[model samples]
Target: MRTRPSPRSRRHRRTRPRSAIRLTAGFLAAAALLVSACSSGNSTTSAGGRVEAALAELPRSTPSGLAPYYTQRLRWRDCGVPGFQCATMRAPLDYDRPDAGDVRLAVARKKATGKGKPLGSLLVNPGGPGGSAIGYLQQYAGVAYPAQVRARYDMVAVDPRGVARSEPVECLDGRQMDAYTQTDTTPDDAKERNALVAADRKFAESCGARSARLLRHVSTVEAARDMDILRAVLGDRRLNYVGASYGTFLGATYAGLFPARVGRMVLDGAMDPSLDARRLNLDQAAGFETAFRAFVKDCVRHSDCPLGGRGTTPAQAGDRLHAFFRKLDAHPIPADGRRLGEALATTGVIASMYDEGSWEQLREALTSAMKKKDGAGLLSLSDSYYERDADGGYSNLMMANAAVNCLDLPPAFSGPEDVQKALPAFEKASPVFGPGLAWATLNCTYWPVRATGEPHRIEAKGAAPIVVVGTVRDPATPYRWARSLAAQLSSARLLTYDGDGHTAYGRGSTCIDTAIDTYLLRGTPPPAGKRCS
Candidate 1:
């Protein structure tokens, strides 16, 4: 499975890009980090909160003069990884006015090998307004998905505009990104807070300088429009999709925009479009806490847990981890050439929360950092989360993540003062992650482009049955979000995975995999409100 770090802005939005896509074996060895990192955290609100208000106010209609763009054909050719065919599709940069400009999107597909009759095309997006859908398909989904599902449907992916392989949005160089990632997210005082603000401003300014034109056009709404064009070009009457994390939001947006054209959709690790950035962040903070408690419960049951031993309370375990963070804040440990400071160490911990499979690695890393003063393991985990290759080259994941998130919603906080006022609430929500995540939300405050989208409900009233899956303790996209999104979509069937992890399908649950597989193969969704363990 591909693990993607939480999208840059939301911190833990999607799984890290799978290791199979990386050029180096060094990163591939750290593949667990990718899966763990993707489970970070996402800030979003409950879909039922403000969506009704927003939906009632907006008009529902397709924009004029878009028929030609949507109906255009694609000339596919072999490219990138073997067995994958690539194509580029044209979309209006400004959907409001078709002649303004064009945004080129990259698409890739792996044709089915199964003998069964084709079930049509299955578009898979491994979330990230910034994550590379093409990369995800080539590295993980094309081969890693159950052979049964891969056999009947052509697996396809389209990198959203401003994401990888498309017309990507550039912000900072490798060195610059290293500095940005290392920048202290938890401020100590006025000087530290000012430094945090300056870092955010400089990052925003750099994006503006390098991608002035594209920045304004990469909102979720526009990306959804692009999907429609891809669907028409692929000759599919309706969309067949499996969208994870933020991809859930994208899928929902498409359903809302074209309810009649909706097809079978499986939104795993769903996001609620109705929540504003602040509420999203706060809820995400709480989510991390929930996942952490789950981790603590498991950790304390083991003899090797660095945080606690058997009989230790979850709260006490949290305090122990917090103390370690404070120690790192005061004096970072050396890790290869870099240092394992509080920021990096926190990121490493957050990375492991995505999937329980990484908990042992996290425990080992913690032991080394606390006892041996060796920070290499944790640093490696942090590096994977940031998508830093062995040579120090960085992907556009973080830049695109920030770009898309900032454009999709208003800033979570207006200024440092506002964050200061909100800190107590954040801390109350998640004593361990609250302060740092709250500061991370400030990233969009100095964004160069104004947000074009707002919090709203996606009620795809006339759509086909869409399956929404939620992990009860998913760290990034909380389980409540699945409940909320399922409620918002008019034709949604809620599948509850009473388990720990970021998403459900293909993660080892026979119940989840079977239910989804049955739905895709037979066009019969599992009974609504179905529960699985």
Candidate 2:
């Protein structure tokens, strides 16, 4: 499945449906010139009570047979991205077999700029299961983050294994990816269905052919282990982190694996790890339906809405959009060398859903495509979603996304029959998005590596209270996930942003921002049931 937004802010925008998360900003890197912008645990505890839940003490000793990794020193050099320093750290390729081989991870940081000495490193991850932490660091977090927080904590990011700059997983070349993106997910005939099946198999086989070993090692658990080693190398007593979307899952995994090592942490756009692959896919499908409903509700108020007028119901608007997708299924819209088929156009629409900042652009793009018979605008958005450069190159975003997702959990569907069985539920969840997303789930059915993880709770017992932020209308990581995660974490405090878009923290809610700022700065999480709009 096409993972979130290719826009950089959300991770799992996919041509194929898969539950993946990544940083928000990566998607916009290639298409920004076109499509523009895009809490806590503990209920009932008073602010005083929360502060009393201080950062927990961590064990000083390293685990057995891994002293070399734990004690490995780093040599920082200029990252060539002014003001950021880069270094490489080594982690065991297989934690289960530390001596078999090792993988080198790229790390980058922006030192604290404030006057006195800094508190410690605050690690940041923009959760692409495939998103590049170092990329997010250099591009957004390291530079544009809050000044007050930056002054006290040295900002750090590490490219998880098999992501960008960290031996990224590569499958198809640019041309092949273009074809893959154009494949129809809502097939109308046996021929089209078989074609999608072939595409899915080819993609998995290509990834296996090119990145077999990396694929086997790129699970989130391995990445979490790498983070622990990074924390130790950074000389931090505990991990202070801000992980978004899938990053929340990563942070939660860290907390669960090493509870005593937990520190001040924020998981924005939290994903519930307790659900299996099928449930996550199903829930995400429903989440997109929710976002689309919100979009249609607002879209109808605008005069330029392509779907409907002021009095049109959201259901009616969805019906129109669904019909339009059906038309594209029969007759694709030409956009430069490539065409905007049902798949790409749908992806373009979903990309705009990540952040409402692009809603205006989506409106214009839709107006042109539906009214003027042009597809360039939507094509640009799709390209951005895939991180496809103008030069016809692709980032390993999709490849890494699939690699991690397939290994993180077993396939959501074992074959086309399974997809067919899930169709009704998927369609009911998101009439405009469900079928394609369900079919998208089929991409992993042909994966090479077996799953290394499974659905389970991450209690992080005795860990410091974590701030879990959720956007009620978040399309990718549904808000309910945040609630579930918060309830599961032993010391979690849930923070709600009753607004649109993906992650909540830096998206401009004063209530949300101030609450997180105070927590990251003073280690006092938001009080239970704190909701921001």
Candidate 3:
């Protein structure tokens, strides 16, 4: 959620309308287990044309200022998993000149504890670009994976640079963040809008001030290279990975840079590297609109829903919610000694937008806000997105999110004028989402970094079998990204999860799980373009 300058956000409606905004929302592990599974390890291919060619295409490493850094030998702590021990990996602050400063990536592993054979290490990244790989390790990967897969491989994860533990991207402090989060996103006039613009400028300034050195180096390409170094250090002949969401981008980039080194890989919730800035943002806005429609249809069925009632169509329900947002914009409700305004309310709604399991929670939050005028529950959800602490301190998620996003591509818009020009197209794609998202997409226009990456297809020609997963109704990474990515990668397979939610790996689809488990454990790729309900 990077902030952008808005001169129009300050416009107080001469007469306020009702509407609402919604909120929106990584990791691998390792352990040593030796097991004889149904599948056996494939012989590593010699570095030759395919893999070596890909590596040859990579840009020379830039100076990352990561010298003078030392890997901290973490006392392996058992995180309740029998074979898994967590440690931290340290690399030079700048990989180009390893003699410079260093950064620490929080790493964890479950040792292979099986008989007959071993498949080396399998690294997992739960997408966030900022998501805690270590957290994902302890909570899910350590236990839930199929025993066959678990037994044969050491599960490993390292939080990427500028992510959870690897020298996080620092930005605004708590109070400033609160103000930035609450800044009006919807504007009716020039004055209110300028305030929004100011907020974005301040956020960028804070990031530049606090994390200038690291900000320039947090691109997905760089992160992928880091994984290579980690792979080398781990002594794996080839890298095996399971990446979700942004992790998919990282994994794909890794394959593009070091194709010959790729072993078996799974990229869930794949992002289309082929889509340009405006298209990506517009498509995501439409994706949220799709998810919102699904939520509305579900909400109407529940008797307790606040926005759905007599004659309330899903479209109307959406309208009412939007109306609520407008009302909140002018007169925010008080909650927890803070103002619970449209920005926070929208964030809360968007947070629940990721998973249908949270629909009931969203309903309750909306009801409380509508009926009692209390917005604490909703505010808390938004806070979770911002990774804000109770004391108002903020994590570096927003900062890193902005840095990576800005560097990945050019700004979607130059300013409000640019957005206004694109508004009709966006609104047509998603009447419920167009305006705000169009404006939101403009944040990169104010970014300090000149975008370096573009939306180009990453073929990673001749890479080993890679599986690309898509959740049909995912708000952040739409299903089409999977299709596009699969088409882009020469050896990619598209595994479709025709369901709701952000990513589809362990979200209870037998089809998704079985196919992926088989690939991870048995090296049998899911048939290309396979559909799962």
Candidate 4:
């Protein structure tokens, strides 16, 4: 379970280097001479053949209205990585025109350790759609993955275009983001409801005005194409990948397009690519409800539980949180010179809802907020989700999150009116979160670009065996997504962890870890729907 701090502010930072492909005006002249020299001997196939073939099949057609690519040098510099240097790659701002404007993509890698032989580069994406893969790799994956998995492959990470290290999409600055985090999402009246709608609209507008050029291009389809380019430059015949959370959607996209070139893939916390936005949000709402019930069950046994009383029941936990949300809306608390309202409190607590590790912190934060009228702890947790820094600058998480989400599928609701219409179904799915999250569904209603795509099933027929891991009580990527993805893929093996969290592999399920490790190291898939306690 990933535990983040409250919403504050932070700025984006470029973290990695692209492969050694230089896109310059001197390309055609130098390419002819180099090709002649390289092909002089056998004149047929070599490692370079893999590179040529990979690039030949890429989509040359970019979207019609996309901005032209603007060429950039990407100042290459050292990033304190040992035996690994950092640089950047520039690709077309739009894939249609290779000679147009370009955008910088940040890439990173720790070279394969074994010198005897190297299989190839293995790319890893920790699924946020907005989550910084480089940061996730540096912080955990690079060091923690099994040695057998690490020894034969070079571990690589790329912040997808419009994401963290890649020319990130910008929205509100830290202070403005602070206001967004505090905006009331759940309303008790028409006035409060209108306010919520306004806040969401403002957020959409901010992203549009600031990241207009990149917003439409941040779709999962485009990101998968970018990965293909990276694969070409890395000199790999096939793509080896491990994706979690939203990354599952990305990996699946790659498989959908290039199943023939697929290698070992592990999708943890998989998203159901077939679900429409409304269904996705509603399912996630229910997932959170499931996780909260688990927490409430645990809280009932704790002596310090503030919400449970002699008359309280496990079922009442949802109502108790709902009541507290109402109270905070009526009167917000002050925390560290910031106002903590129901929206922030709810977002904060929900942010912690992803992983069981943070449940204790959530309990403490909720107790303080409910009993002492202090909202600082909850605020901190929400800030972490938003990737806000202490000084009040904002990272590009929220910006990229909305950008990718908006492009991947049509908005869940057309407007507040549509959201209201869907409320009944959402509430039926999740009494605790349905109403507010249904409204949250309206966040992308005012997206700058019309959605170019819609949710559809991905049947990656020719792809190699892929492992799909799911947690029964995952809040963000529900367990059903894992089931759905496995069903979609021809060779998918489902590994179910009867646990709580956003993802299952590394969050302390022996059964989950052992199964995944065996798959990655030995190329053996766990049985379909294999359940772990």
| C-alpha lDDT (0 to 100) for residue 322 of candidate 3 | 85
User: In the order shown, what is each candidate's alpha-carbon RMSD?
Assistant: 7.0, 7.8, 9.7, 10.7
Off by over 4 Å in 2: 1-7, 10-61
What lDDT score goes with residue 88 in model 4?
A: 78
Clashes of 4: 23
List ranges where model 4 is wrong by over 4 Å: 1-77, 82-84, 114-117, 309-312
Candidate 2's residue-wise lDDT over 383-431, tens digit each? 8777788998988887777777777766777788888988999888888
Find the 10 residues in a row with the least total lDDT in model 4: 21-30
| Model 3 accuracy (lDDT, Cα) | 0.69
Deviation in angstroms for 358 in model 4? 0.6
Candidate 4: tens digits of C-alpha lDDT, residues 1-533 = 01111111111112111011000000000011111111111111323232111111223343443322222233446668654445576666655555556777888876778644676878988765567777766655676666666787888888888978899989788777777667666666799778777877787788889888887677777787678767766778788898877777788778866777788888887877666666677777687788888778777777778769545665687888889988887888987688788777877777666666677888899899899988899888766666677899877766776777777666767777787788898788778767767776666677777765554556666679988888788776778888977887777888888877667766667788889877766678898668998
Task: Give Cα-based local distance difference scores for all models.
Answer: 0.77, 0.77, 0.69, 0.67
Q: What is the lDDT of residue 471 in candidate 3?
A: 85
Reference-based lDDT, residue 370, model 3:
87
